[model samples]
Target: MGRELLRIEHLHKEFEGKTVLDDLSLTLREGEVAVIVGPSGCGKSTLLRCVNALEPVQGGSIFLDGEEIHADPRKLPQLRQKVGMVFQSYELFPHKSILDNITLAPRMVQKRGREDAEAEALALLERVGLADRAKDYPRQLSGGQKQRVAIVRSLIMHPALMLFDEVTAALDPEMVREVLDVLLDLAKQGRTMLIVTHEMQFARAVADRILFLDDGGIVEEGRPLDFFDHPKTERAQRFLNTFTFETVKE
Candidate 1:
């Protein structure tokens, strides 16, 4: 564990008068991996969105690296650069080449020279085993490959924290492993991450801490091994029993 990188205190959120999250709080340290898991509609994705400042909370606050997010709307663009987010959808520009898609942010937002941005992008692509696909478009790559490219795109920004919102949710069963492998590699590299996932095995394998959320609040949280093998609450037990398939590779 390292210094605190993200802190959420008394967080609250709602959509159209319906509560999605209520009084939730959490802390994540540098080089730590915290995985949020629970039944669907438990506010897992919404929590990630709040941390990324994509959703405005009704109360409480989120601080990333000591800077309060949502405090200054003007600084959001700069603040967002410190947090990289990957969604269930690949969200790639269909018309752009992989290289161009990955380098666009660094070039446009960061004002890095084209050569420098492209050089780093290509290196990241190669690291993810997609260097040869740099010339290809999103439509040309498989779902797994496109997702890997999305991860590389985020990495090029040099974000201090990465948020994954059900990244494998949209992938085909067979394609899940390739994408999860990249995440496992990142975990090995000690990148700080907060993930919302239903991939139980992968969650157990990668998480430094596990948060079991239900009805918009944390029901139980602890080490992955303890949570999986010995859930404290009946809610967590029932939730774990519902997943029977071995969707994630070892």
Candidate 2:
């Protein structure tokens, strides 16, 4: 097997007296692209947030590259540096220019020099076809453009595992492709990613493993073709029957 890049064991999380993540366990291998799909309120986003340390888990452990994430508070910054995450909202600093937004984290947390950080950020912008917009403010960009900038902001950190939570959900239909294309290129280049998305076609096209989560834990997991076409659990089958490309896109 490929060396495990992320390991989650018996994860348990609660919110307001309700269990949100219940005894969940999963592993992500280096360079593997794993997509998570489930109905709303199934704790998909919570799982990603927990992994990113935006939320604390009540139980279980998460290890990234064999080092425990919650093991050392002093090391949290270092651990986070290796795990990049982007959410549905493009949380760019409204007052900062695109270049500044991309360079801030690297310059501060990463301790990269200003010139070095800008140089690398510029190249990443070019990769996503946003080089010319470096001086533009967040308000000046399209929804797609803003999301692209958010993505590069994460990539600039050189994260080993990238987490995406329904990134395309807020975009107009025409805009989703640009963001997905960027992710597709990243996957092709072999970045380890864990994504929570309802974009079935994108998941089917890119995911190495597709997991169906329900009631706060994984109900079924398999190859994309098998999971979508031949899901093992009734919950998964019902989920598939409930959502289709048409219903989702609308």
Candidate 3:
């Protein structure tokens, strides 16, 4: 399946006395979209954080594009560049214009020339359907637009993989779909994505496979239809049963 682009082996994490993740292991194919789902505080977010090295892993290894990023400080920048992250809150800089937000990383980290970076940045804005709003500040845009801008900002770096931590969690019901549409498009484009989300329908519609996490480890994983249609574990079944007509995207 195109050489595992990401592999986690015996991963563990602890916060104070709480065990957030325990020997969690999983692998992602180069172009697969793997969705991580579970109840709150189940270590879904912790797992994602550890992969990006945003949080340290006390044990185990995380191989991203064949390099271990678990304990090596030397590979931090390179690993981070390869793994782009989108948080629940759209963390765009308030004062920076949309264009500035998208170009900030490429210009600073990648050191692309101003004109060169801006050219790419503008195209990304267009790609996210925000080309006309390039001059607007974060505060001047709606929640959906801001999130789109945030996605474009990350895409500007041309990351090999993307980590989405409930990217639409803070948005209103109506705003959630817009962001999901963009993410779905990204999936269709064959971007390797590791997403921690509650959007069951979105998962059903776009995910190639689903990983269910509980307590601290991966409880189950399979194709969306197999995982959801007939969940093997009681934990997964109970988890799925909790959703109502509103859908859990938000």
Give the winner by TM-score.
1
| Per-residue lDDT over 173-231 for candidate 3, one digit per residue giving the tens place of the 0 to 100 score | 99999999999999999999999999899988889999999999999999999999999
lDDT of 2 by residue, 81-180 (tens): 9999998998989999999999999999978999999999999999999999999999999999999999999999999999999999999999999999
| Candidate 1 vs. true structure, TM-score | 0.97
Weakest 10 consecutive residues, lDDT, candidate 1?
241-250
Candidate 3's error at 200, in angstroms? 0.5
Count of clashes, each model: 0, 0, 0
lDDT of 3: 0.90
RMSD of each: 3.2, 2.7, 3.2
The alpha-carbon lDDT assigned to residue 137 of candidate 1 equals 89
Please give the lDDT score at residue 250 for candidate 1. Answer: 70
Worst 10 contiguous positions by lDDT, candidate 3:
241-250
Q: What C-alpha lDDT do the candidate models reach, one value each?
A: 0.95, 0.94, 0.90
TM-score-better candidate, 1 vs 3:
1
